[model samples]
Target: MNFIPFLIICPLTFLAGLVDSIAGGGGLISLPAFLLAGLPPHNALATNKLSSSIGTTASTVRYCKHGYFDKRLTVPSILCALIGSTCGAHLVLLTSDTVVKKLMLVVLPVVAVCVLTDKKEATQVAAFSHRKRMLIVCISAFLIGIYDGFYGPGTGTFLLLALTRLAHMDVRTASGNVKLINLSSNVAALFTFLFSGQVLFAPGLAGAAFCLAGHYIGSGMVMKNGTKIVRPIIIIVLILLFIKVISGN
Candidate 1:
């Protein structure tokens, strides 16, 4: 509630936004910052969703402006992300994060390794038509959406990775589409957290302003630097997330 905390958080939000816009692990910073600010766990998570939803929305707009979004494929993923977030929110209330924490330890390293080791050339080839890929993407989004709603950390990274690998899209295209899907899931989770009265508005809004700025800057970086840079950043963030999850604090 103090202005001093806002000062500390603003820069972190900016950093989170920038990294998140690039590779999808912004929560790796923001959520821990919120918790350290003395919010209850539920309140911290909900407030995080509120702040991050704004950033992701900004990224979606940025992507749209850059002419990378395909509505036909994106629309279905958005719809499923919404549904999945709802399911995930409920699951969060009922389930424990122990299993997810353990799994992340393995998954993050693997994702990082694959991205690091992958030598596949980027191609414009349509590995699957929009309709078929939509089905696969929808299912993937739904599952990840649940994760986003329940216990979000690296949702963006997972979404981007899945899109690139499973959906056979390039990194930029996947990042663009990932924003759209992430926005939907964040909105869904935001609604649930709002109804539950778990959000802390002041820090959230303050964090969000910086987050928006970060998204703008980060999106440009991704567009300019391409996946070569994005991939390593993703790996680092995921490794950070792995440590955080394993620490179980």
Candidate 2:
């Protein structure tokens, strides 16, 4: 409720948006900033989602304008992801949180190892037909969607890495598509949080403005620098998320 505490989050949200637009670990910054602002844990999460969703939408528009989207593959993937995430979220209600947390603690480390060791080979593939690429993207999107809905952290990084390795698509293009998927998931989470009455409107809006600026600038950098920069960023973010998840569990 204090203006000053919320104000501090604006600049930090900008930074979160910047890194998130590039490699998908924005929550690593924004959520903590919200909590430090004196919000309850659930409110911090809901408000963070609300703010980041706006910034991500901005990133999606920027990427779309730059010609990075493929509707054929992306549309199907989006649909699958929505279903998967919804199911995953529902399952979370029915399942044990401790069990899920332990599972992720184990799996995330292994995923990090795979990302570090296999990326070079993953990036080397030549090409794929539209149909094949669509199938892989859709299936992966659904699975990741479930993960996002059930427990979200590094969904974008995972999506980006999976697309790069499995689809063997252009990095810039894959980054673009990742934004779309992320935007959808964020919106889904945002609505759930919003209707639950957990979001703080003032701080959430302020953070959204800053996050928009950060994401706008970061999207430019990604287009210019290509995968050479983003790949490392993703790996680093994933590692950070892994550590954060393990520590929390």
Candidate 3:
């Protein structure tokens, strides 16, 4: 609503985009930036979606250009994510925030330990057949999309983990597919928020520019550095998520 708020929000949003493009959990930073800048919770969430969806689209394109996307899994994953997000968004209106936040608190420590202990190379080949992998990816997309639409702190990060571990994808391909899945879920959630007239276009669009710049640069880093860059960021994001949940924010 004012220049002062953008001053605070834009830079953090850029950082959010950067971290998000590389490892997911951008919302852990960006949403709080909005809240810190004095937007109401609903407006912050809606506007953050607008800015992030734009930024994510840029990174998704970059990943596609780098030939990291898996063509066979894209359509089914996107479809399931869309449906799941729609359901989650609706479900949120009926649910209590306390319930979800408490659930995340329980889940975060185990996730942190797993990520910390994982020592496998990022280039490992999948053990699952194509059909099985597709099934795993789609189911994960749908479930994570529901989370994204409802609570939405670490959707991208969760998707990345699921892709890498459960689907047995290489990190680069999993990262690329995670972007596609996140973008779809973001758009689905954005439209729901838009319909409710909650988005703040001025700040959202302003934030989008910074988000785009950050995401573009971060995606390049991912393309060049791959796992070396991805793992640490995921760890940082998980820590941030832990803090956010513990604080009940």
Candidate 4:
């Protein structure tokens, strides 16, 4: 196997990690790169998760150290995400993914539009009761975590949006919560790939080291600028994912 391609992939993983840590949708960059690198689909996915989990773990730690994480909320979401990601992984083995791809094609652009049109200024328009919000978050995390395990792109953005819109967290808090859940989902997927022995370790580790740099930069940026930075990055990532999904067709 040619190792030269990885020289480029590592930096891209770094950039994607930075962008993903702040907003979401790192796979928009990494996944296509993997596919182009000539790995089989399953191996590409399994390898991506191996690298991605490390990047996300780094980001999660950064966010935690910055005191942005809410353990009460994060703990529950992490538990739910673990369950959701495992279910999603198993479900993919039994189901056709064509429909999910089609749905994502439609839904991603719509989500992009909403982000584009959203008004400036953070608002807590979240009107759910505490009990209701917890329930919604649990369900949302579970579903989205499954989606992450199966299809894998845009999971962070989905979690952030759900928390901001449904659970009434502001963008900053939503990001923190999203990171917690994402960490769990990535860990769950990593376990699956580990068991299958599909991960490409050499490239994955090289990619992960670079990705850690990006994660550090992204974590600091999010902590400093709050959602002002997050919203635009998320919009960009969503549009990229939309383009990627369409291009794959």
Clashes of each: 0, 0, 0, 0
What's the TM-score of every candidate structure?
0.76, 0.72, 0.78, 0.76
RMSD of each: 4.3, 5.1, 4.3, 4.6
Q: Rank by lDDT, highest first.
A: 3, 1, 4, 2
Candidate 4 lDDT tens digits, 1-249: 487768656776776777666545666656545554555556666778888888777767767888775566777788999999988766654544456556656755555454444443465756667778778889899999998887676787678778887787777767778888998998898787778686888877877887778777876773654446555655554565566556773
Candidate 3 root-mean-square deviation in Å = 4.3
The runs of at least 3 residues in candidate 1 whose Cα sits more than 4 Å from the true structure, single-residue gaps closed, are 22-24, 95-126, 217-249
**Over the full model, what C-alpha lDDT does candidate 3 score relative to the true structure?**
0.76
Better structure of 1 and 2 per lDDT: 1
Q: Which residue pairs in model 3 clash with each other? A: none
TM-score of candidate 1 against the unseen true structure: 0.76
In candidate 1, list every pair of residues with a backbone clash. Answer: none
* Model 4, runs deviating above 4 Å: 21-23, 93-121, 125-127, 217-249
Comparing 1 with 3 on TM-score, the higher-scoring candidate is 3
Candidate 4 local distance difference test against the native: 0.71
Per-residue lDDT value at 14 in model 4: 75
* 3 or 4, greater by lDDT: 3
- Give lDDT: candidate 3, residue 235: 56
Q: Pick by lDDT: which candidate is best?
A: 3
> What are the lDDT figures for the candidates, one per model?
0.75, 0.71, 0.76, 0.71
